[model samples]
Target chain A: MEGKIRQILKDHGRLSIDTTKLAVDSDLYQAGMTSHASVNVMLALEGVFDIEFPDRMLKRSVFESISAIQTAISELKTN
Target chain B: MTTEFSSKILYDDLVKFGHIIPVGVPGIFGRGAVFEEILNRFDAAVSRLAASDHATKVHFPPCINRQVLQKSMYIDSFPQLSGTVFSFTGNDAAHRELSSRLKDDKPWGDLQTMTDCCLTPAACYPVYPTFTGTLPPNGALVDVQNWVFRHEPSEEPTRMQAFRVHEYVRLGTTDVVVAWRDLWLQRGLKILLSLGLPVKAELASDPFFGRGGRMLAANQREQKLKFEVVCPVISSEKPTALCSFNYHQDKFGTIFNIKTSTGETADTACLGFGLERIVMALLKTHGMDPDSWPKPVREVLWA
Candidate 1:
């Protein structure tokens, strides 16, 4: 699953995204990801994990890392 | 309009953060390394607790949808104040597009999209859509910041194509919005005066949309969509707007469908701090020496 998310992170060239040595559970903003890049990352997650993001979660806090992205996908699945 | 804060406060903090760039565009006469230094102090001197009940350490860029912007009626309301995000789109004519970039031709694409994801005329537009369609149970407070863009064609050092803005917005009942606005308006005054920045509170209006915008602006003057915290940034009498307290009275909620748990339409207010203007304000008040600011404000910066 992490492998799948990593590929999606790099898939978009419109915004620069890094997929190497990914850290999970940390705030993406502190890690220096711009808000614009976060939106692209959210679009990538929908493809990798087969989950869609509510407009509310299109923030830095939600896409903190591969694990947080995966966890959000999991939470949305149950609902 | 100019600023009131000392330029020194902005220099040592975020400008030193190493990522900010002092890029230039045509007619954007004020943005050079010089203006960047002044704004740096303003951005750095921000206080987390005093600005509002909320603060988000991260900055949210205003990239909202064209549809959302149209629905908000920003195009019709503040046409003079709007900036749309633009990009080249004739992908099949890729070589032609490249030629336009290289030799400067009539690039087919214009307007930064029919509008930006959000036409960020003010700093607080992002939050309204975030909670649209439903209200927070206990009421949610968001401290948001952005490098807000405005279409003022001014060459003054204080007015620029873009500037940093800090806002703490409250979403809830009419009472919550008013209480938060009233409370912060008081705090905003104290902080400016503490820094010895001469400021005044007066009814204000958004630079409305178009031909009809004048009518709206006049009505706004009557009702006051805005209140400016003016201080001497450029000159003593030419006070810069350091902060603004706005009461939208459900105009945004009504448009965005921001409602409470009770399914009642919500009211909203924002407490905004113009970062560059504040730095300018401090520069106007305290001069450019970090050594000269009041012991308290200076200590806060050093701390």
Candidate 2:
């Protein structure tokens, strides 16, 4: 799941830095991922995981870092 | 002193005095002649105040190209507020069906297809597409006025669904853009102050949609990217934003391939004056009759 998330980030994150070197807890927005790019990332994640994010989970903290995204995906998958 | 009840009273008074004509729409209304005169005079006053800047003036239509709107990424942040154009492009048989549905009062929205253009969300949006290249040493400064549409409808007289904005856009290096925005923040306050309205300038954020949008809005506020000059036009507790100052740090430049003379992505800033809202503020402040307004305020606008 982590590897897949990284791949998705690399493909759609539009971050200024390489995802391979980014820490799991690093702030994606601080790394130059724009609000526009973040939406694409969310859509791609939903498509890959086959889980729809509820309105409550659609927040910045949920997508702030790779770890946060992983945790959100996990919660959705279990549900 | 202004409450929800007073707001309704104000709206009714404006309509009674023929300042605003209710066209049977909540947030849409036709302007009376006196209201139009005041609007035009206030618009000219703003232009006069910014005359020293000598910005290039441009007029844009109310709708922009759909592709440009998508590229600007407005839909991602404000899907709820965006308005897209739709039109009927069908054969004779389909037209007859559409006509029948319309005559029968059945839903006919499905018969229309989305057009290549959408209603312009902001007055400055169409300007970015025109700057898809490098700027001069001094960069670019534009003065634009156009009708902007947002989907929100309400009983608040100040919250119009369609309105005009007089906007000034500056595109250049980071320092230049930021400085321009900061300068305008002060100038905007002064412009409203000169009109004798109880105005205040404060940090603000766009009404981004959805749960994700709340985070984006908080981030925006934290960055202090937007500021609004607000006036108590309808409610004192919840003032209306008469003007806004926004600093877009290379967002449009990156999207539109705009560059500075130094080969760096250009930063952009804009200051917009809500024409109708300002007039509304003036009416609320000085009473509805323009001729009876204070001599100094009347001179500031009429002069």
Measured with C-alpha atoms, the lDDT of residue A38 in candidate 1 is: 54
lDDT of 2 by residue, A1-79 (tens): 8888889889999999999999999999889888767777888999999988886666667888999999999999887
- Cα lDDT tens digits for candidate 1, B86-193: 664445567565676657655445412342455466667766787877765767677777777777765455676677788778788988778878888887787677
Tens digits of per-residue lDDT, candidate 2, B189-277, equal: 98789999989999999998865676667667767889999988777788899999998888999999999998999999999999999
Per-candidate DockQ versus the true complex?
0.01, 0.27
Q: List where candidate 1 sits over 4 angstroms from the true fold.
A: A1-79, B1-46, B51-59, B91-94, B97-119, B294-297
TM-score of each: 0.64, 0.89
